[model samples]
Target: MALDRFALPARLRQSRHASLLLFAATLVLLLVAAAWFTSARSDLAEAYSHVGSRQQALTAANQRQQEAKLRVQLADSARSLVERASAGGFAENEWGERLINISQTPLARDEVNHLLAGMTRDHARIFGADVFELSVTRADEGLFDTPGSKGPPLMLNLRGTLLFRTAQSGSGVAAPVAALAAAPAIAPEAP
Candidate 1:
């Protein structure tokens, strides 16, 4: 009977050792599974974060495109408005007739005299005393000799200067002298 009891105790200890080993193995597997699950979750979160950032970038680009289109439309509308105002308000009616008359009309001697009279009349400080000599020469012959010349020979050169009243003091008190002195010097034209 004693021998049987000792054998029974030995068997119980062997079973306990086996159960402990199985429990340890199961714990190790659970730890590995938990670590793998955590890693997978982290990877999924990173992918979702990347997708969200890309979406934000795409939205920004779309907004920029919309803004650019709006600016272009606004500029076009403003330009059209300016064109309409200039065409309809100020230069619409007489502009064409004025241009045609300027191109077609040839200046006459009476017109030149009237123009000069008007100029002297406008400035009250100057009076024409006498026109010393008057000469008129046609300049159209030389002008038309060139190739590609348009229009008829209509140019005339008038050489004459009207004597105007001036201060006898001959000092710089004369208005004509002041005007000539204040006038800007003509720059030589480019070749």
Candidate 2:
């Protein structure tokens, strides 16, 4: 009976050791699985973050493209407006209307005359002042009309010989057209 009791105690001790070893092995396996799963989940999250950033960058690029298109459209619109205004002869009409308004208004005659003379001088300077004879008249008076009736809207008729004296060019009118304009000289022009 003592021999049997001792064998039972040895058997119990061996069983307990086996159970402890089994538990340790199961715990090691569980730790390994948890580490692997955690690392894999972190990698997936990082990949998703990168994808989200790329999507945001693409959206910003699209917005920039749309803004560039809008800028181009605005530039085109401004260019078209300038072209239309230029084509409509806006400057000439404005000058004409302004002249008519000034003449009709009760402004000082001397002031108006001074303004006209200055404007004319400026115009002549722009034309290089190399003009031989500049005669302006309104509408077509035909190619072979009388001197008085022929020409476009004749605001003024200037006749002079251009002279370059001391490196400066000037038109020396022997007889002023305006001076002749006041005095009707029909005998000289008529047959």
Q: Could you say which candidate leads in lDDT?
A: 1
lDDT of each: 0.49, 0.47
Candidate 2 residue lDDT tens string, 1-191: 99999999898899989989999999999999999999999999999999999999999999999999999999999888867754553222222111111112222233334433433433112212322222323355432455453223323222222111111112232322342233222221111
Error of 2 at 172 (Å): 30
Give the Cα error of residue 143 in candidate 2, in Å.
Answer: 47
Q: For model 2, give the 10-residue run with minimal summed lDDT.
A: 95-104
The deviation in Å at residue 96 for candidate 2 is 19
What TM-score does model 1 achieve against the real structure?
0.35
TM-score of each: 0.35, 0.36
Q: lDDT, candidate 1, residue 75? A: 99
- Evaluated at residue 156, the lDDT of candidate 1 is 30
Task: TM-score for candidate 2, please give it.
Answer: 0.36
